[model samples]
Target: MFASPAYAQAAGAAGSSSGSTIFMLGQFVLIGVIFYFLLIRPQQKRAKEHRATIDAVKKNDVIVTAGGIVAKVVKVDETEVEVEIAPNVKIKIVKATIADVRTAGAGKPAND
Candidate 1:
């Protein structure tokens, strides 16, 4: 027979392979931690702040809707708001559609 015989790996090589596997798993865990701190945590914080702002909305507050319409809050209900986009022109909108709220006197003059 001209074929060469195959030899099995030494027992010590098995231990090194297991050590490398643990190191690889540790690397994945570290990456997951980095992603949570850099990406996931901040997003959740922003969502919480946005929810608070929406909940604090009341009559006379100026709001910008998700559709980019700027209006004054005429009435605030549990899940909806009545906004006056123009004098005597009001529309009911979902509270969640409000993107930003500007309380009275918070507006600065165009010159400023």
Candidate 2:
């Protein structure tokens, strides 16, 4: 009788172990889904929008560079832009460095 009890307990432990493994795998899958929706998806969307903005940059547009410099786009080349940060102060920056492009008269003061 004692030997039979030992066998029954062993069988029950095997079933419970498999059930716990399934539950653990399910928890991992759920966490991965949550991360994709909450973190990865939104980041990809923003990157796409930023790329569109960078591509649409043109002359005379107000742009903010990645280095935090705000200037006017003097010329838009195939891979670079010449920005005039001040009176007669121009610099050629890579197209990818253009962080944001503001429209004409968008950032100027009303009284000016």
Candidate 3:
């Protein structure tokens, strides 16, 4: 039964248990920061820009819905918009569902 003192000395030189825990926590924090920048921030920015685009909708602006329906805006309300997908046929849609707004251009064709 030989228990060498060098075994205890080797264990002491390996690493601190608390330091490994702190390093693991630092890794988690770093992952969170990367996710915030890579996923969360860009999505919020796109939402903000889309909101701005929706709010700026006006009569005669061409807009495409999230459902891929391209229509010309007939009337703009606070929360709803009137869009004509076809001649003499208009439908009301929520403002948030509007995906893109094309500004009024010179002699742009109507949805009719």
What would the TM-scores of all predictions be? 0.82, 0.82, 0.81
Q: Name the regions of candidate 3 deviating beyond 4 angstroms.
A: 1-15, 106-111
lDDT of 3 at 19: 91
Q: Residue 76 in model 1: shift from native, Å?
A: 0.4
For TM-score, candidate 2 versus 3, the one ahead is 2
Measured by TM-score, how close is model 3 to the native structure? 0.81
Instruction: Name model 1 segments beyond 4 Å from true.
Output: 1-15, 108-112
lDDT of 1 at 55: 100
- Candidate lDDT values, in order: 0.86, 0.86, 0.87
lDDT tens per residue, model 3, 11-71: 9867687898899999999999999999999999998998898999999998888998888
Task: Report lDDT (Cα) of residue 95, candidate 1.
Answer: 96
lDDT of 1 at 10: 56
lDDT of 2: 0.86
Q: After superposition, how far is residue 1 of candidate 1 from its true place, in Å?
A: 19
Please give the RMSD to the true structure for each candidate, in Å: 4.4, 4.3, 3.7
